[model samples]
Target: MWVRVTILGRCLTDGQLALYRIPRTKITYSNIKYDWGGWIMVGLESECGNGKRKSGGCQARCAADGATARVTAWTHTGIVVCASLALVIGAPARAGTDDAAGNAKAARAPVKPVTGRKKPAQAAAPATPPAQPGAAAPATVSRAWSAGPGTAPAPSAGGAVSPEVAKMIKFAAFDKLSMKGWITTVPPAAESIFQDPNGLRTALAEYGIGYVAYSTNTFTANMLNNAPPKPQTYQGQIPTTYSFSEVTVSYDLGRLGLTGGQLSVGTMLTGTTWEPLGPSGAKFANLYYFQSLMEDTVQLQAGVFYNAQNYLGLLVAASMATGPQALVPYELGLSRQGVPAPGANFMINLPNNFYNKAGVQRSISPDGADVEQQANPIGLGLSSPDAKALFIDEFGYKTFSSPAQGSVWVRAGGLYNTSPYFDFSAGRKTDTNWGFYAAADVQVSQISSAPYEAYQGYYVGGFYMTSDPNKNMYQNYYEGRVYGMGIIPGRPMDQTALIFGYTTLSKSALDFQAALTGIRPFGDYASVTVSNSFRLNPGVYLMLGTSYNVHPSATPRLKNSLNFMASLTTAF
Candidate 1:
């Protein structure tokens, strides 16, 4: 028998099938008998048959024979009841074999047609496998992360920072600051040092020390003075003269958010010294007593400042003098010659434009020169010589700015001194004294574009200080103004100052008339200042400077002075 089968959605023909053996059943043919156990059937169809009968009753005869012979006929119709029952009850089913002579004929049998319907053209190809989870997606390179809302998500491991927090972080990094230091060099006589006229010459120093610390707040301290002057004439020299030395410490407390403005407190201690103008000048007297002059005097100062962002600022300060109170008498007595005499003076200063890119400053000090004498003059020597009280008032303005290639500064000020005891003695004891002083300084290459080592510059500055006639006692010859200018030039180790100066003293008489009345004496003075620095290495330096003053009125017309200094600084 030929058979067809379907497996895994595909049909298989008999040629592609494999044959197997099993137990066989009895069979009978029409009017023909065969052995009961090994009968074979031929020509089977797999489709269901139509209900139709042949005229000769072939189907019925075939069925009767199939029953009598106990043979099974494989067909599209139902099988015999007993045979189907036997097959279902576990009778082994088997394939039929064709006769060797009929095999070729059986292989040529036609296949039955499928009746009801046909199978689908083909089962759809197996679906593609689903994608796996956590797989990376395609990526694109970019210069910066996308900032659009809901576009690029923040890192999953951490939370996002708020805009305010991010802004604060940026500000902190940009606004942070630290402390720094600076060094300044000031020339001689640039600073005031109050000293006694009859004391030892201890106020002179070659170099001064400065300490500065700055951050948001700034602090500065300065100590400077000039070399004491030598004597010029015999009777014209005093046993002791007051030298001026000031130590000022200023603090900028503006950074504390106090907004109350900047505040500064400072104290100055000025010593007394006596040294004449030249070789022919007289020696100092009462040196021991003069040494205690500054010890008995104290100065107290307090100031408040207001600064605006537009490079403008204002300062108001009040200063008071207290101590032995006798130093005033000695200072007044020395006013007989030269500039206005130095003394224990009380002043109120108003400074403006303290710190700005333009560097402009203006100040006014209404000073009381004889406050101590008006109170007590016991320790000052001469006893109560109908002396008039003295007062000194000063007003000045200074401006410093960079212009193109260099820097320039101008300072103009006036001084007025008055004494109450104008005509105490022979009208010669006139009291009120006043004068004007002004100075201008310019730096040639301070704003140069070259490297600091190759930088070159020069400065020219001058000052004029004078006082009107004042007859308060003692001698009052040098009571007028003095004028001078100094020229500074060079860079690094090469620097010098060529100074031309002069002073005029009021008339004086040795015998009240001296065969000469209303006599005026004019004096000419000249000085040369040479300063040089040798840089031993990057961390070491040696500095030397000297000054020579020539007074033509004395026997020895040449006055020589010198100052030397050396220091080493290192950085890490």
Candidate 2:
């Protein structure tokens, strides 16, 4: 057991104080009159005095005059004297063990009447000043202990266990943890939230693999006249056109270790325009009637692709297709002829020069009208015939990086005809041709961030036919050969060609894109093409373009011919 006591008044040396607690059978007292004026333990006191007002048998008296004393008990020891001063009785006056002599000396020195100074009214019992404004109240402290099986330890102030810990404890006990929220956009700007989800959807739809285009071609021919002082010329033409567009929708089933893989199918339409490369100049036999060597076709394909990061990706596809013949003019005919002999039955003689010119030489006819006359006997359709062919094409591509920066991609593929569709005279021979193609593309940018966008990229491509020994045949008859011609040739039988292109996009007050493409037949025809597109607003665009064909073997005066077009496009 522990005990505590407090006195309300001051004490003089030699004074005493007592404390008591009733019914405990123990008495404790203290002498308040010492050097360190506080409680001191005295012997147990016996209860005495009046029945109601008790007094102590063991009492402590002050040793000096004017000294104050108080006593409390552990068990009803005595009356507690809380006065500031009390007369001493039978007490020491010398401040030591001697009392009588000390009292005598004090009496002799203080005989003068006590000065009327009312003892400084005992200093108002030292007060506990009212709490200062805004002061922090004393913190409450609690003490608790638990004795149970598997109980947790109590937390301490300023300890490792925190309010956050308590919250987590409650959450862990009653709720499921979850995180759901939107990530705010940064670089706060007008379009910061313009995240273009559609663009992302489109990209994702393409999976990771992409495509490239390629084409190549060449031309050849020879002509001779045998009369002296004769006017002679050689003419040949081959035109090749190919257009490919593919949109793929793919989903990644990551569980299969094929994260970047996808399935894609697309459509490709190829057509070539070919005419005689001559002084008269090559002209589309059907252009006057708006009939272009144009053939539109659709292909249904499916394949798997793998993209490792954005750095590289590849695709392999097998496709079955049906459309206009890839190769043109199902049948072909070649012939040499001598000038017809003068008509002896003429009623009158013609110019002497005419007769001499017809007699001196067995020369091939420049127009070959006689060949066409003899060829009609075969009853095969010429350049003007309509027929479709079936074939399968295998395609693949490897892309190096994102299109935003410089990137290189390689593409190769082959088209194989599944039917016996080639008959030159029947306008189907070009249908049997097949070929391989490849190309590369690159882009450079000025700013990597946003706001101002600018970039440039260029592409080069080539393609070679495997079975078509007459390359110029397809170029001269484009509509007939939809799959295997690279360019229009100046003459017959040329087998190879190449095409190069460049494009640039820039943003200022307005956004614009421009591109230039050129096709060259190894030794014959050449053409320069230009295309441009501009944004009129957020979702509207305008396009304009033109192409000029130049034939070196044609009359230099008529080497260049133009084709132009314009269009408006909109997006939702």
Specify the highest-TM-score model's number. Answer: 1
Residue-wise C-alpha lDDT for candidate 1, range 457-499, written one tens digit per residue: 4545454444332322122211111111111232232223333
Q: Can you tell me which runs of candidate 2 are displaced by over 4 Å?
A: 1-397, 400-405, 425-432, 444-467, 470-472, 475-524, 551-559
lDDT of 2 by residue, 1-572 (tens): 11112222223334542322221111111111111122221222232222221222234455454454443312111111111111011111222211223221111111222111111101011001010000010000000000001112222221223333232222211111111000100010011122224444223323332211111111211112111221211221222121211122223322244322223222212122221110111111110000001110111111111000001011001000100111121111111110111010101112321110000111112123233224222212132122222222223332221212322333333333322333333433333333333322222222221101111122233322223333222222110001111112321111111221111111110111111113222233343434333334332333333434443222212333343423333222
Clashes of each: 36, 55
TM-scores for every predicted model: 0.33, 0.26
Alpha-carbon shift of residue 313 in model 2 (angstroms): 15
Q: Output the TM-score of candidate 1.
A: 0.33
Alpha-carbon error at 243 in model 2, in Å? 15
Alpha-carbon shift of residue 217 in model 1 (angstroms): 30
In angstroms, give how far residue 352 of model 2 lies from its true place. Answer: 78
